[model samples]
Target: MATRGTQILNPRTGQRSVFLQTAQDTGGALFQMETFHPAHNAAEPEHTHPFQESRCQVLTGTLRFRVGGVERTVKPGEAIVIPPGVAHHFWNDGEVEAHAIQEFRPALNIEDFFVAYFALARDGKLSDGGIPKSVLQLAVLLKAYDRVLRPTNPPRFLQRVLMETLGPVGRLAGYRPDYI
Candidate 1:
């Protein structure tokens, strides 16, 4: 399980996350972290948390966010709240590194998902766009973290079909669902 002070670095995305209050610390009420995002960092894939709400408070530099198709630039001391099941993505286009305090309500296994995803990146198993290079790996990760994260494109039903079909094959090929 995640604990305060645990850190994960993703070189592919030039981002680092340090856990502040984990599920254990918060009695499953919230998961909090401090994220360091380098300048010009790429935005994450448009996605949604099916059952969790997220909030991010900018600490330094500027962060750009696209929430539910609306774009906004957030600066220091500003915060953005993303409701559950909303499609959103964020990036840092400023010349300086950006920092933010992020929180997720109804703490789930988000930290585990991050650890697994970043591990793949650290192991050089992800592409330049921060996606798993292998279809099997992608299936495994997507299937495992479906409740916490879901890609916005390709449609939800399509994703479900693919994950349901390929997930078993990926697991049979020795790709376990939980990397952490």
Candidate 2:
């Protein structure tokens, strides 16, 4: 079971997330949390979830989001919903920290994903931006998780092929599907 205050750090974006609810606590219905993202940092590259929908509500500071090719800035009390399979990315472009609540529907293994990702970062296995320095490591980790990166450079198809090819290598290197 996950507690209300379980926190995870994302070194790539310099954000700290506190879990407000977990899949176990909600019987797999939802996963919810508040993220404290540092200024001028992007939380993640554009990505998509094949099996989950997301809702984000800004609580403090300002957040910039690019959803389906449209970019916008959201402030306190603002919210946005991202349907499954939609390409989206967010960041805190403001001077102050950005606090926002994010919820995922039909929670899968996101909690575990966060745990493993943060652990890798803490172990110095990842770059300063929180990305694994090794391509194999990144492929293995991403393949084991739900979210898929949609890289704009090098074309999406090529990236997908690389991920598919490297996934098995990553597993062979002893990466598991989930950390929790």
Candidate 3:
């Protein structure tokens, strides 16, 4: 379980996530976090969660969210809910920093994903945009959290096939699932 106030920086999108409520604190019901996104940061790639829903409330600056083909700019105090299996992504579109609170239902291992990903960034194993430098590394990381992140582009079938084929190769190359 993540401790309260635990913070992680995602190098790829220039967002800092500070955990507020963790799965353990809520008995596995939910996870809540406060995120600070730098101005004009890149958007998270459109993705779907197979078993979790998410809610986001903008606290400051401007945020743009695209959910299920609908795009909206959320200002301070505005909020949005993303249903499970719906394709969604977000970006900081304001001239200043954007602060938002995000909550995930049925917590899952989303927190762990952040920890591992950020650890990779700290170790210089990721690109400037936060993507793993190696294809095998990306495969291993994504395969470990397949249930939580399903990219919407390039078709799900192709993504699955590629991941499935690469997962073993990544493992054989000594990629472990956890970074910390």
- Model 1 C-alpha lDDT per residue in residues 1-180, reported as the tens digit of each score: 668999999888889999999999988899999999999998878899999999999999999999999999999999999999999999999999999999999788888888888888888988777778888888888888898999887689978886999988999999975664
**Per-residue lDDT of model 2, residues 135-155, tens digit only:** 877777666673523334335
Model 3 pairs whose backbones collide: 12-129
Clash statistics: count for each candidate: 0, 2, 1
Q: Report the number of the highest-lDDT candidate.
A: 1
Measured against the true structure, the TM-scores of the candidates, in listed sequence, are 0.95, 0.84, 0.89
The 0-to-1 C-alpha lDDT of every candidate, in the order given, reads 0.89, 0.78, 0.84
Greater-TM-score candidate between 1 and 3 = 1
Q: Over 4 Å off in model 3, which ranges? A: 127-130
Indicate whether candidate 1 or candidate 2 has the larger TM-score: 1
Window of ten residues with lowest summed lDDT in model 2: 146-155
Provide the lDDT at 27 for model 2: 88
Alpha-carbon error at 73 in model 2, in Å?
0.8
Q: Model 1: which residue pairs collide?
A: none
